[model samples]
Target chain A: MNASEEYEIMIGNHAAAYACKGAKVQVVAAYPITPQSPVVEKISYFIESGELNARMVRVESEQSALVACVAASATGVRTYTATSSHGLMLMYEILCWAAGNRLPIVMNIATRAVGAPWSVWTDHQDAFTVRDTGWLQMFCEDNQEIYDTNLQAFRIAEDPCVYVPTLVSYDGYILSHTFMPVRLEPQSRIDDFIPPLKHHLNLGDMNVVKGVCPVTTPHVVKREEGTAPGYYEFRYSLQRAMEHSIEKVVEVHDLFAEKFGRSYGNGIYKAYKMEDADIVIFAVGSVASESRLVIDKLRAKGIKIGLISLKLFRPFPAKHLREVFKDIKTVVVFDRDVGYGYEGILFTELKSALYQLKNRPFIKGYIVGLGGRDVKADDLINGVLRTIELEKKNEYVEQTEFIGLKLDELDFLKKGGKVENGR
Target chain B: MTEEKDYQKILASVQKPVEGEAGKTGSWSTIKPKINLDKCIVAKMEKNVCHFCWLYCPEPIITRTIPPRILYDYCKGCGICVEVCPHKAIEMVEESEL
Candidate 1:
C-alpha cells in the first residue's frame, strides 16, 4: 500500500463512511436523517459495488436500527450505525441497553439541535443529552478528526477494557456538510489497528442461548444475581474503561499520527495559545474554529487570550480542564444550546468541575448559537473582551449572558436601557 | 446427538408448574393484576371472552379456568396483560410488603 497518497476532498459524513469501511464493519443498520443520511448512502453504494462485503439491514426506525446492530454485534460481527438529533433521541433507550449489555457497536452522530420549534441545524445539545448512557462520546473538530475518531471509536469500543458502544460526533451542518481535505488510511493498516471482533457471548450456538433468557419473576433468586454482572458489573466496568480511555485515546492518537501522519491532542481538552494567557475562551465544534480566529485577532492586539477546544464531552474531563485553566484568572464558555430555566449545559458542567478548586477563575457562561444561528468571529471576540473587562474590574459576573440577542425588538425596554427582566 | 442431549437437558431444567398451582394468586408480593369484577366482561356475563390477560401474559402467569386468575408468584410485572386486556379487567397493582 502506498503511504504517500494525495489528499481527497471529503465531507465529514463521507469520511465517517470511509472509516466504517476501513474498520471492516460486517453489518450496518441505519435510517436516514439530514446531514447523516449521506453516510449510510455511501456505505450502501460501497456494499452494492462489491468494494465492501457487508449485510445492510434496512430498518424501519432508529430503535430497530440499533437493535439490529446490537443483535449483529452479539453474533460476533463488527456492526455500525449513524444517526443525528431526532434520530439519536429515538435510539436513547436502546443506546442504554446496548451499552449495558457490553456491545461494541460504533455509531457516528452528526450533532444537530433537537427540535420542537423544528430547526434542522447544528448544535451539541443532542449529543450532550445522552452523555450518560454508557457510550464513549468523542467530538471532532474537523473532517480528518471525524475520520480518525470513528476508526479509533471502534477499536476503543470493542476493546475488552471498554466493551461499550461509542458515538463519534461532528457538528451537523458545520462539519458533516462541509468538505475538507482528508487523508484516507489504507485498509490493511486499519485492519491491523482494529482486529476481528471477539464477542463476550455468541448467540449462534445451538446448545445455549447466551445473554437471552425468559422473563422470570422478580423474586427469582438467580435472576437477582444475574442482574448484577449483567447490569451493575457491566456498567462499573464500562465506567472504569472510559476513565482509562484518556491514556488509550492518547496512545491511539499517537499511533495514528505515527502511522497516518496526523494526530490531534491526546487529552480530553485541546488548548490553543493557552501557555501564558490570563483569560481563555472555551468552546467546541465549529464555534471553536471561529474562537481560534478570535484568539489570533486578540493576540495581535496584545490581548492575553487563549482557546480551549473540548474534544470529548463525556467522562466530562473535569480534572484535565482544571489543570489546563489552573493559572488563568477568567474563563469564558460559549454554549450553542441553553438548558431552560438554567445556565448553558456546558457551563453548568464546567462550573461543577471547577467548583472544588481553592482559587478558581470567574467562569462566565455565554449562550450563543441555537437553531442553526451563525456565530461570527466578532461575537466570540466580544465575549472574550467582556471577560477581560470583568477581570480588569475584578468583579465577577454572576449571571449567564446571551452573546447575540436582538434587544432592540423588546417593546418593554427603552433603547440603551437594561431590560427589567433578568435571565 | 450431543447438541440434542444439551437441548433436552435445558428443556428438562425448565420446571413445569403442577396442577392447582396455576391460579393461586397469593404468592405474588412484588406485582399482581386485579380483576375489577364490575368492569370485567367475562366475570359480569359469566362468559370467557375476557381471557385477554391469560392470553397476553408473556410468562403465562394468568390461567383460564371457569374464570382467569393470576398466578402472582411467577409474574415478572411487565404489565403486558394489563395493557392488552380488551375489557380493562386486569389492573396491575404494585405489591406492598407488610
Candidate 2:
C-alpha cells in the first residue's frame, strides 16, 4: 500500500462522504432521507469536527436541499448533496434547473424503491427516474467503487468541456449500510487529482454583472446590440454537452487510473472473461456484482459465459457496449427495476443500441430484485441456463421475464377471475 | 472542410446584463406619459425635491434630477409615473395623437 493510502472498513455512505471531504467541497445542502441520510450526516460530522472546511446547510426538504446546492454551484464553488426515493422525487424540478444552468453539481444517490406500498429498500427506480435530466448517471457496485466513483463524479461534472451535473448512485442498504474495506487516498493526492472548480461562467464575480438562466424567448433575440440564444438553443447546448461528455468521462477515468493506480474498464462498462465467451450476462450495480458469481458457476459447468458490469448508465455507452457485444452470441440482461408498461429499462435501451449491427446477437432481459426482493444466485444461474437453452432451441423468449418472483403459489391472482394480462 | 457546429459557442442561457434586453419595451404601449412643467413640483420649485414619479416608475425610466426627465427610449409607457405624480402634472397621451 502507498504510504498516503489508508485502509479502513467503511460503509458506502461514509465512503461517499469522505470523497466529498477529500474533494474539498465548499457547500453541502441536504435533507436526511432513509439510505441517503447517513451520507449527509457523515458530511455534517466532518464539517463539525473541522476535518473538512465546508458549510452544511440543514434544509427542511429535499427540494430545498438541491436548490441550495444549485444556488451554491452558480457561484462557481464545488457543491454536493445526497438523497433517495421520495427525496429524489421532491428534487425532480430543480434537477433540470441545475443541468440547464450547467452548474456542475455532484449528487450521490442511494438507489431505493419509490413508494405507494412504501418500501425502504435497494432498487434502481429512484435514479432511473431522472436519467433524462441531462445529468451524467453512474452506478457503482461495491463500497470501494462507491467512494472512487464519487471522487471521479466531481471531476467529471466540473470539467469545463462538459459542465453538467452528475448523479453517482449505488444500491440502497445493499451498499449504503453494508461495510467493506476501502482504501482512502491522502488529501494531498486527491487535491492534485481534483483541483478547485473552474468554469467559463462565475456568478460569484460582482465586477461582471451577468444574468443567469433567465426566461429566454423561443428564438434568438437582440439585446442592447448583442445577440442572445433562445430557450431551444440553451436546451440544445445541454444535450450537446451530454452527448460529448462520453469522451470526457473516459479521459477522466484514465487520468484517475494513471494517478491512483485503479480504474474501471474504459470508464463506461467493465467486461469480465468475455474474450472467448459466446453468451454473456449484462447487469449493473449490485446485480452486476452478483452476476460475477453466476459467471464463475456457468464457466465451471463447461459453459462459455461471461459478464459485463455497466458503470455509466446515461449517455448509455452504446458504442462501447456494441464493441463488447460484437463477438457474443447471446446476452441476458438482469434488471433490478422494470420500465412498467414495457420491458426492463436496460433491456429495451440495449436492443435499440444494437439494432444497427448487421450481426447483432439475440438478447433477452430479466426483471429481478424489485423493491429489494432477494435475488438468489440460484435464480440468476437458472435464468442464464434457461436463456442458453432457449438460444440452442432457437426459441423466441419473451422480452422480459421475472426472477425471484414467488407469485406462482400465491392464490391472490387466482381469486381475481378473468384478469386481462394474467401470467 | 465543412465547419463543425459548436454548441459551446452558444454558451447556454447565460448573458451579460444589458438594458433593453426585451427590445424597446416602450413600443408595447399605445399611450405615453407627458409631464407638464406648469404643475410639476420639482419643475415649479426648481429645487431637488420629491420626485415621486422617478421612484414609482416600474421600468424606472424617469431620472431623479431638477425636473425628473423620463428616458423614453425603453420605457414601456406603463403610466405608473402619471399615477404616482403627486402634483397631477403627468398625463398619458395616445401615441397616435402625439
Candidate 3:
C-alpha cells in the first residue's frame, strides 16, 4: 500500500499489479487463469478500492480479454492484461489483432508449461509460443523485475516509434507465486517516467473514418496509387518497430535506473561476474538469479565462468550477444523450454545470433527445467562441465542435451507401456 | 488546365480507404448476375417487400428498389444472391451469354 519508495515483501503477481496500477492504465481486461489470476484479482481490488481509476473488465475468455484491450487501445486509452499458459494460447487469435492494428497494449504472462495432460507450472513454452506474434517479449529474473519490466513495458509499448504490443514475462510458480521483497517506486516518479499512452491511429481523430485491422487483400505493399498501406508495409513497420525498440528498451531501462535507482542489465540482459572470464552461461528468468550462486561456486573451483541473463527475448539482442560471444571461447545456453523438433528456443536463437561472428564461442545448447523441474547447482555445474568436456575433446556438441531428464520417466521406458490420451 | 498529375501520388477518392485497400472491385466481374424481372420480389410479385437477395449479397452491390438491381460491374458473381433469393429471381450468366 506504500506508494512511495518503500520495500515490502510481495508476490510476483501482486508486484505486476502494483506496477500496472502505477502506470495509470485506463482499461484492464483480463480473465482468471493459473499464476495470472492474482494479477487481475489484485487489479480488480485496486479498482474496487478506488486505488486504480480504471475499468476492471472480467471477460469469460482470454480471447475476449485481449480483443477488448485491442478495441480500447485503438480508441486512445492505455490497456493492460495478464494471462498465462492455456489463457495465452486461447488468446492466440486476437494477439495478432493487437499487434497488426499497432495498438500499444501491454500484457504480462506468468510463463507456464503448455498442457496436454494438464500441468500448471513454470516453463518458457507458453511465452515462447508467441515469439513470432509481433510483440516485444521480455523475461524477468525475479519479482523485482516483474514490477520493473511492467513499468518499462508501457513506455516501450506506447512509444510512437515502436507502437508494438509488449509482453513482460516471469516464471510461473517460481516467481509468480513466490513472495519476495519488491521496492515500490513513488507514484509521482512513475507518472514522470512513463508518459500517457497514445494511439497512432486515434479513433477519436476526425480523419480516421474507416474501420481498421483489415482482412487479407494481397499481402504486398501497394506503393503504386490509391491505397492507404499494404500488409507488407505494416509487417515491415512492425519489424522496424522491434529493431528500434531495442535501443528504446535499453534507454528506458537506464532512465528508470537513473530515476528509481534500479535496472537489470539496463533492461535487455544482465551479466553476473562476466568480466575476465573465458567461459559464460547464458540463460533467462529465475535461472539467471540461480546462476549467480552457480558462478560463485564454479569460480571458487577455479572455473573462469560467468553468466549472461537475457531479459529481452523478442527484439532478441542479437548484435549485443554477437559482440559478447566474440570475446568468449565457450558458452552454455540453458533453455527451460524446448523448441520441440529442433533445440531449445533460446539456445537456437543464441547460437544463430553468434554463428557467423569471428572467434565466436563454441556454443552448446542444454534443455532444462521442463514442467517446473528444479535446476539446482549440480544440474547447472554438470551442464557447464559437459560443455567444457566437449571443448576439450574437439567433439561436435549435440544440438540439445536434456538436463535433469530421467529416461526412465518416459512412458515408453516404463515397466508397463501405458498409452496416453487413448492413442 | 496546366496541372500535371502523379497517378501514384494522387488518391483515388476524398474518403478514407476500406478494408480491401479501397479496391475498385467494380471491374472484378467476368460473369454478371441477371435478375429474372418476372419472379423478382420487389419488382414483380411482392413490391416493397422481401429484399433477401439484397440483404444476403456478399458485396454491397445489390440495391433494393422497385426491382432489386445487381451492380454487375462490381459483383464478382458467386451466386450468393441466387442462393438466398426468396423467389428464384437472381441467376448468374456468362458475360458472353448476355
Docking class of 3: incorrect
- Fnat of the models, one by one? 0.00, 0.50, 0.07
Which parts of model 1 are misplaced by more than 4 Å? Answer: A1-5, A206-234, A407-423, B1-98
Per-model tally of clashing residue pairs: 0, 0, 0
Q: Give lDDT for model 1.
A: 0.78
Best by DockQ: 2
Supply candidate 1's per-residue lDDT for A276: 90
For model 2, which pairs clash?
none
Q: Specify the poorest-scoring 10-residue window by lDDT in model 2 chain A.
A: A206-215
The TM-score each candidate achieves on chain A is 0.90, 0.95, 0.93
Candidate 1 structure quality by residue, lDDT tens digits, B3-56: 322111121011233333345445545666777777877777788675877777
Q: Which ranking of candidates, highest lDDT first?
A: 2, 3, 1
Against the hidden reference, what TM-scores do the models get? 0.77, 0.83, 0.80
**Which lDDT value does model 1 have at A404?**
73
Model 2, A253-311: lDDT tens per residue? Answer: 99999998988977998889888999999999989998898889889999999889999
